[model samples]
Target: MPVTTELILARHGEAHCNVAGIVGGEATCTGLTDQGHAQVRRLAVRLDQEHTTAPMSALYTSPRRRTVDTAAHLADQLNLETRVEPALRGLDHGEADGRPWTAIKRRFGGRPQQYPHRPIAAGAETWNAFISRCRAVLRRILDKHEGERVLIAAHGETIEASFALFLPLPLDDTELAGQITGHSCLTRWQRHRNTFGHDVWMLAGHNDTNHLRSPMEVIT
Candidate 1:
């Protein structure tokens, strides 16, 4: 027997800071830009069509403004309530919470590996901490919502962390640097009964962005 669940992970729309190349960590409260809003609207419309009657049972969102807004719109479309999960928040950047990427690259280009663990300027959290929290949160969500389909609205870092967990990779700065993207991904997990009386969770789909590139127009 196979116990399966579908997890839809969506990156929040482009924030004003994103367009400006700002490093928006957990502390940053930047909302979505106009284009970002349009993208979310398009996503909602598409979701509505796919799930006109059979929709996700619940919706989860990070505490950030952009995620909250995106979740709100999605909740309206699905007729579901939105729940906030602080653990789903973006990586905390301590002192460099809102600095531009260019500035960080300029200041620490030679030592990129050390940047994630460094204090970031004042008292920001390290990349290691961010990965740990995100992994824990995702695990909790999976356990709590077993066998149900869920939609999560979160930041780029949050999505990356979730992917890394299912894929089992070391969360290094170089790895994180290459994971950020605009499209959404679908990850499905299935629980199977083994001959030895053990249950295993297997990956069904990983990093799928088919919906974004379909013939339908995805504003993002």
Candidate 2:
């Protein structure tokens, strides 16, 4: 029988750069703020409630401190081991690390054409590369746990990049750029056996954050 999997995508809580208007990338490192901790606490509670019956089978996270910390909390609730995976790390901003958004805008005279496609100053990973890395990591996770309930704590950029990979929409680069926010979602994928004995993947959910009651639920 083909196996179906559920992925709970949780964006890491706020970091200092997130509140300081700085563009955070793999190169620029920051820890979670007090509010960030609180946000994750709320997230932990929400996940506990949602999975009270279903139960998560495993917990996974980026090696980044923010994501690791968030996954630790979820792991506590689920009694699962937290696995740190480097492939889940945020995009490499290269030269843009620690640069304020205002400075970036000033350099470009405005917001660049679109994210990923738009170069940040001079050095940064292109959108295609960002998407490819995210795809690779997500695929590895899916293959590792084909039919289990898995939880991933990652960055907003990582989540958005994965969204682009799973959903076939007419989202431009700019729109794709704006999709990531500090939030969490529940997404599932099921493998269906066809008449020819082949398994096909199906879309279950995308960016569902009902746990976030409102904008207030998002802690900066």
Candidate 3:
């Protein structure tokens, strides 16, 4: 049976901090770059065209500037109001929040994923705690919006979390567990009942960036 309950996750476009090689936590994020805006506009057009056939029921976004900006473009295209979910925000970087990745690496000796059990920085979120919140937020979304096609404009890590939860993949704290989600890429999942009547979430697509492949644009 076809599943009408769909969940689409879109990673926010490139931000200034991304170009500057800094961690874009809530305290440091400055929103999307012009190129990022262009990338998302293309995605919005694609979604708008697809909406004629499979309209989305709701749109959600994290409170970060980059995510909010990405959601704004999507909202305009889909004619849907953007609902902000604090739980959907990216990992809390704590003391590393506005610091350069290079500097942080020099201090911490490796990436945050390298030390999953510990904080990336003072007052930061641990890998375990972060994945737990991600799972909880996704569960809440599925329960509240069952049978409806829902979209979320969120961070790359949030999208990663969805894959971990819905696909029943291990939340690997020691390293990058799955493919890194690209900027403004779309990942889709559909929930359906299996032969035993157990609910299952099937991956429809992952890291889809077809809309950004125009001749005028260069994916970087």
**What's each prediction's TM-score?**
0.80, 0.78, 0.92
What order do you get sorting by TM-score, best first? 3, 1, 2
**Global Cα RMSD, each model:** 3.5, 4.4, 2.9
Query: Could you tell which candidate, 1 or 2, scores higher by lDDT?
Result: 1
Please give the ranking of all candidate structures by lDDT, highest first, separated by commas.
3, 1, 2
Top-scoring candidate (TM-score): 3
Residue-wise lDDT of candidate 2 within 1-220, one digit each (tens)? 5556666678877777778988776666676888777777677777777678878887889887778778877787667799888888876666877899899768765554365466666676665666678887887888898777788897776766666666633335563444635444445445667778787666565566665553333322
Candidate lDDT scores, in order, read: 0.71, 0.70, 0.86
Cand. 1 TM to true fold? 0.80
Stretches of candidate 1 exceeding 4 Å from the true structure: 1-3, 110-116, 171-177, 183-220
- lDDT for residue 39 in candidate 3, whole number 0-100: 90
Tens-place lDDT per residue, model 1, 1-220, is 6455666777777677778888776677678888777677677767777776657877999998888878877887678899999889876666677788778757755323355555455576666777778999998998898877788887777766776677666856553444535733444455666777676766665555555556665433
lDDT of 3 by residue, 39-104 (tens): 998898888777798799999999999999999999987899999999999888899999999998
Q: After superposition, how far is residue 161 of candidate 2 from its true place, in Å?
A: 2.2
Higher-scoring candidate on lDDT, 2 or 3: 3
Candidates 1 and 2 compared: the better one by TM-score is 1
- Compared to the true structure, candidate 2 yields what TM-score? 0.78
- Tell me the number of clashing residue pairs for each predicted model: 1, 1, 0
Winning model by lDDT: 3
